[model samples]
Target: MGLFQPDTDIFCHRDALREDYQPDEIVGRDEELQQYIAALQPVINGDQPANVFLYGKAGVGKTACTRYLLSELKSDAVEYGVDLTTIRTNCEDLSTSYQVAIQLINDLRGSENRLKPTGYPRRQVNEWLWDELDSIGGTIIIVFDEVDHIEDDSILYQIPRARANGNLKEAKVGIIGISNDFKFRESLSSKVQSSLCEKELQFPAYNANELRTILRQRADTAFYEDVVPREVIAKCAAFGARDAGDARQSLDLLMEAGDIAVEQDADQVTEAHVDEARAALERSRIVDGVAGLTQQGHLVLYALVMLHEEGKTPTRARAIQDRYKIVCDRAAVDSLVPRRMRDHLNELAMLGIASRVERNKGEVGGRYYEYSLDTNPDLLLEALDETVDMVGVTESIRKRRS
Candidate 1:
């Protein structure tokens, strides 16, 4: 038994990623870190009355910085007898104005040290939330993550002017909006644009060198010393930077590479190992993204791609329906037509998976069209864990000769 037979995976749970990962003390984000801290500085001095809007592309550390700064601001506010209440919500779930209000009231009541339910009426929740804030007689900071997903402007109108809202004769509120979508600021109603855009912080993508620094940091903190070589981290960083300069992607690549080395019972994760891991991770990520879609949408896409795989992929609506049933059977789900099927097809088209082609001459009227999958079905299914259905999808598959 040699000292270095192989560096198999020594799994560390912290390396596993959630959509929300704070990079604080994990990687270098000096510029982004300082801007965020400065923006929240006013809150500490009781001076920055304006709200902040933070924007950047996905995986660019926008949310992480906001969270880190807000946490610190709350801690410092305590010393000044500043009754600072920070309520964080994902705007995706609280899309509507009413949902936002309901969430705000619920959060506020919970923070009062006497965990009471808001119990406010549905129709009156927004009004009640405002009144409750007024009664608190202090400053409140509401941070909305994924703020672009907010369906309306009501919540924005209310937060910045919570003090002006007749009910807010007591407390004042400062808004902090975080969004991955850059258009969120411009898309806001003119009123919301003016108020919430008072201060803006933008996070840029990490460069290759930066990704390397990030990867090495995670390597040191997450893995046992020398468990993963510096070269492995470099490979992961280079791979991710070439793809999109995505830190999350780089981190995922490192984790995936480790898994590959482990599965192979190899002691060290090598370049070839990382390549195999990248392919596997890429497919898994794509599949996971698709799997998050509605079941029917998934079925429709799988059906079309499988049809393509079989060279029996028909492009017409009825043809798609036929393939869709085959897919449903493979998925062991019931077939749907007209309303449900149309809805699913439209969604697939929207996803850029399956697109509609013009119907040929003699085809039935009323928009008879061909539908096709953008990628190989097997690849997609592999990525999405849909391979389970491959053996059973209605179409008979002929194996290629090895």
Candidate 2:
């Protein structure tokens, strides 16, 4: 047999668990689906389109739900004779209104008539966009997935108000702004908020039960009978719930488990494979997160990791700062001030690399925070070892720990 021999024993249809695969029925989002269907009801009634804002954490089914529902809406619009058109784009890299506008125009215009990504005034872009919408001459829903990445509220305010402001004569346009950032809505200007959030919908993270149902559904289609046992499914769902109630994470975990089983030439995926897959995913996440941090951030996290190994953690910021200074001195890098160090600590916590807790000392010491490594210390040390200039610090800490 060749080294790359096809193994059909594990996954019958592995692509079913992929990110782009849309399930026939969204298994766990009944409530959100009903509310979502209601939100799009205006499109079917030939009335003004509804401007909607969808907010949720990553992998909690925001984009999946949007695509699924839009598909259904389009079918219904055809049957009901409601002129509806939906255009979708992901704004993760589209940082400004001009970029987003250009993207939308290109998406509508197709490759032959696509405009350049740069070199156009904002007003001209808006005018072209309005002209395109007017030419479509019906209800148009513009879905901006990861919409929070756009730096300004200019596009958000402009698109929804296009028809009302007379920029669009025939097409009634609505905006569906989807974001994983919880604070993006509050960060928008008041006018943008009122205009874009006219029909706000929230997709809460999936609970363990919901995740289980979803995993099981995918497992049945993605694998042969009994290839993925119930315990493996449960374990993946539990891990996902503990992580963030993210369906995408859960699904990815399941897929990774299958891959592990295939690598081992195992007959079925087991809980052991699930555990191994979880650790592998976490290690990659830590590596990526650490790679994104600054030099000071690395030192701060290394200090916290050392403290954790020494059993000095759940310790306060001052102690970590002191150790950070020591790490910096040993590496010949200047230490930042305590205030700036604390900011790095906060950023680590936000990244899920560290955990923070608030402590009150009865108004005498006032309120302070205690920090500790939230991830595996060994994994963090390994990541630090790979980072520039941190190898010495990481080796020293490993020696001390050993």
Each candidate structure's TM-score, on Cα atoms with residue i matched to residue i, is 0.71, 0.91
Poorest 10 consecutive residues by lDDT, candidate 1? 393-402
Most lDDT-accurate candidate? 2
lDDT of each: 0.71, 0.90
Where in model 1 is the C-alpha error above 4 Å?
1-26, 79-81, 111-123, 262-266, 289-378, 381-402
lDDT of 1 by residue, 118-170 (tens): 45465577677767777776677888888887788777877787666565766
Best by TM-score: 2
RMSD of 2: 2.5
Q: What lDDT tens digits, residue by residue, belong to model 2 across residues 83-163?
A: 899999999899999999999998888876789989888788889988887888888999999999999889899888877
Q: In model 2, where do residues sit more than 4 Å from their true spots?
A: 315-322, 336-347, 356-370, 389-391
